[model samples]
Target: MPEAGEVAARVAERLGTMRGAPVSVESARQLPAGASRATYAATLVDAAGVPEPIIIRAVPAAEDDGGLGAEAEVLRAAADAGVPVPEILDVGLGDDSVLGFPYLAMNFIGGESIPRRILRDDTYAAARGRFVEQCGGILARVHRIDATQTPGLDELVDPVEALHALFPREFDAMPAGLVLATQWLVANPPPSSPGSCVVHGDFRLGNLLVDADGVAAVLDWELVHIGDPVEDLGWLCAKAWRFGGATPVAGMGERASLLDAYAEVAGWRPTEEALRWWELYATVKWGLICAVQANRHLDGIERSVELAAIGRRSAEQEFDALLDLGVVSPEVVPDPLGVEATVPDEEPHGSPSSFELLDALAGFLRSDSVTAEMSPQVRFHTRVAGNVVDVVRRQVLLGATHAAESAQRLAALGVADQRALCDALRSGELDGTDEKVRAAIAADVRARLLVANPKYFAVPHP
Candidate 1:
């Protein structure tokens, strides 16, 4: 993370060059909540003494973010198509003299991006009711953008193929359910759409800014590409994006309402079969992404508690895929184990126990670290850290038993370990119809979810 002073200085220098006159940066601060890129809000005064609020999005120097300039172009094209998007103020600032990293700047638009708030807060109740239709219309407009107009934008030839190309290591580390879903997708491909257009690679509630009127603007165009327009529709309806709500469309409205709204504007509605295929694809895509995010942290590319937590969430997506594919019943719960509790041996004990130490750290972060003195970004990260500690605490208590049970289940399946079981499932060596395979995978996912997030099993899916 860049210091606020460094960000301010860079913004000042960049503004001076853009305006061809001296410019002053009043403040620059990091914004919370983006996972892929770093965003900074900067207030600057131009030579005319006019103050401006601008957002600068920069790719971390350590990561290969291939599309900052392309994202800017896509934003412009979306705006030209009458889609609500932030105005792109500047682009192509790759030189170290400007920002020390490639960045794009845009006029800041205000609205709420948090899904929990958007879904349950009474302030947004009206917006929640109308957001689905609004998003449907906006997505229709975005999909209408001419692919030829955006010459350099990448095309998603095959989403499944694209996902396979992501991890060249043969996916040995992924969850069995995800591997199974990928194989299923390969065997049962969706009928190709006759033509292609711009598809918002990620169009979900968190990426949308909602206000009382409806969706204020579509944000995060980094994944923008040319593909079947229905990809966006299916992504929007994905269960993972639903955020625990029973309703499919962003957890706000019915799938029929979304489809109806899209048909009203786009002149065609996708068949239920096509939508199901894409929805399944969305589940697989999200599961793979969760795995990749976890790998980023585990591999030391980015050390983040949030990323590590997201890695565990791959199980949630896998369970979702199984539910969608009819491999597991939606009501399937983790089977209770009957292991006898073992008493701890006499302590050659030291200061604080591991559990106590983690408890203390989590309590400190939650109680002291999240004060007003801390920036929102810092506070957010502190909370995430606290949550991570809590997860570790749970793992310390339950992980061993969970691992033993998982191993026993895999051994019963004639597979030595998770990797082998996943490989077997992927290669179609294990019959999907076999009750033993289904039960074992379900129980395994249940055990994993119990360690990762017990709340998932507590809440019923819609």
Candidate 2:
């Protein structure tokens, strides 16, 4: 990865050559939230002395454009169709000399993409007020885009099956809740909308740029493909994307309003069953993605506490899938992670037990005095590291209890373990729709979430 100054220099060189004048790098900063590419927001000044702001998306030389070249073409088509998207300035898809890799540069649009701020901040009251309608209208436009305008749109074939295949590949022992969702999904596949259209493979809060007025630009076009457009709408409605908001539509608005807005623009509305099916699919897909991220840490590829913490969050998606499947138990589990359960008087791990030490560390990391001067990124990671410690602490306190209970549930189901339970569900040897099967799976998921994210239990769901 190149440093900030190197990115600025490269941006200056590329723009200078294109503008036929000398250009100077004014500034460059790394932007958060891109998983696959290193993204830099940069400023450059030409001989004319006007500052130009742009975003550079790049991959290593070894990956060579990493499908970013295709994304640029999608942006151009989307822009032509009246969708608010970044204006592409230059692309080094076929050429890499500028940055020693494939790159895409675009004129940057300033906006907030953070879900918490976009949903809660008074600064974005107007955007929050109109998010559903605006996002629906934007999605309707996104779906209506011509696939012929971009050649590779058809490459992502049958996303539903691809997701089904990906989940098993990521985990040695699949969550029982997800197993039920998979069984249900495979048994009741939703019929795709009549004609194929351009689907923004990921269209949700984090990917949508918002200003006070409303959504400013639809970002992250890398997932563009030819598929059922309802996938975009359904993905937006997934509870995982809601980020604990009062409403389900990106946690900012209602689904009815979104459908009304989309119908007004697209001249059609997806059936409730189709929307439900796609939303369930989206949940399963996200769980699989969580597994992938967690595996990256466990496999020694990234070695991040954040990644390890994210792996634990797969339970969040698992629980959400069960919620969508209507098999979640009405009984709520108490928040287990935040509780300060103490060690025995005869401390086995010696003075200041592991759990007690973690409690102290978590407290210090969260102290305003400690975090007050830290940068936002550092503070965020510090918080994550604190959570990672908390997870370990909770595991130490509750791991055996949870494990015994999980094993007991599995035994009641005539399965030896999670892998056996998941295998039985997948092979249809065990009835996923059975009340006992559903209840056992739900209990296991609740236990996982209780340890991984007890606060997640507070999030309201249907």
Candidate 3:
């Protein structure tokens, strides 16, 4: 994370270049919960003494590239195409005389990005009704942006091949339900579409800024690419983006309504088969992404409680994949806890038990850190830390038994470990539909959720 002083200095320097005079940064602060890049909202006074509110999107110094320039170009193209997007002001700064990292500045638009607020808040009820159709229309316009018009965005490839490359080493070792879905995807590839277009690689509810008027602007263009357009549509409907709402289209609009809106604008609707294929792919892709986020924390690249907590969410995606694949029924099974095992209290003279210490830490984070007046980033991470501790507490209570049961099931299926089983399944050596294989995979997924997040199972699945 860049220091507030550094970010302010960089923004001021960049503003000077654009305004042809020295600029003063009045305030700069990091936004909360940015997963990939550091985002800052700043107020600047130009040479003319005109105050401007801008958002600075920058990558860490160690990972800086000229990608911001390309992103600015994409944003311009999107605006020209009639898509709702933030206005790009400047790009490609971070020289020795300016900011220390490559960054893009854009005019910040006021709106809400939280899914729950957009979906449930009475103030946004009218916006919610129009969201699916509006999003569909916006996406159609985005896809119509000719690839040739934008430079440096020609890097396009098969979506399936792209997904295959995202499997991290950790995923291979654990072989969660994603292994089964990936195998099926490889065997049953979707019919290739004939052309490519600009895709909002991360189009979904949270990425959209909304108000009473509906979506004001689409944000997060870091993953923008030229690919199958349906990729965006499918990602929009992914269960991970739903935020606990039952509606499939971003937890607000029905799938059919979204498709109908898209068809009216794009002149064609994606087939049911095509949508299902991509939706399943989205699930697997999110699972792999969760694994990668976790690995970043584990490997010490960027230690964050948020990243660690997201790692546990990979199992939720895996469970969703199983439901989509029909390998597991959508019907909820009874909780794995048949009878609670008694956890012994600390010995008379022993140190505090592991659970006791973890519970205390979790309570402090929840009760103190959250209510403490702090920066949004600090408060968000504090809550995430509390959640992490709670997950660890569950693991402490249930992990050993879950592991023992998983090991026994794997042995009965003639696999020495999860890695071997994944290899067999991926290689088509094992019957994916075999009762034993499905049972073992389902059982493992359930046990994982029981620790990682039990609320996931409580949500109705279709």
Q: What are the clashing pairs of model 1?
A: none
Q: Give per-residue CA lDDT, model 1, range 1-462, as digits (tens).
A: 777668767767776887789978878888896565788888888878888888888877534444787787788888889999999877744554366667787887888888899988988989987888998899889989867667787778877777777664435567878777777777888867657899988999888888877899999988888888889989998988888888888888787888889889999887666777888898888877887877778888777777877877887888888887777656544422223434223277765767668778887888863566887887887788876786776676677888899899888889999888877886778875578998898888877776666666644445
**Model 2 ranges off by over 4 Å:** 61-64, 94-97, 154-157, 165-168, 171-173, 329-333, 337-340, 344-348
Q: lDDT of each structure? A: 0.78, 0.80, 0.80
Predicted candidate 1, C-alpha RMSD: 2.9
Model 1 regions lying over 4 Å from their true place: 62-65, 170-172, 329-352, 368-372
Candidate 3 global CA lDDT score: 0.80
**Tens digits of lDDT, candidate 2, 125-204:** 98788888888899889987878889865544666566655455674455777777777777787866767788888899
Please state the error at residue 297 of candidate 3 in Å: 1.5
lDDT of candidate 1 at residue 280, scale 0 to 100:
89
lDDT assessment of candidate 2: 0.80
1 or 2, greater by lDDT? 2
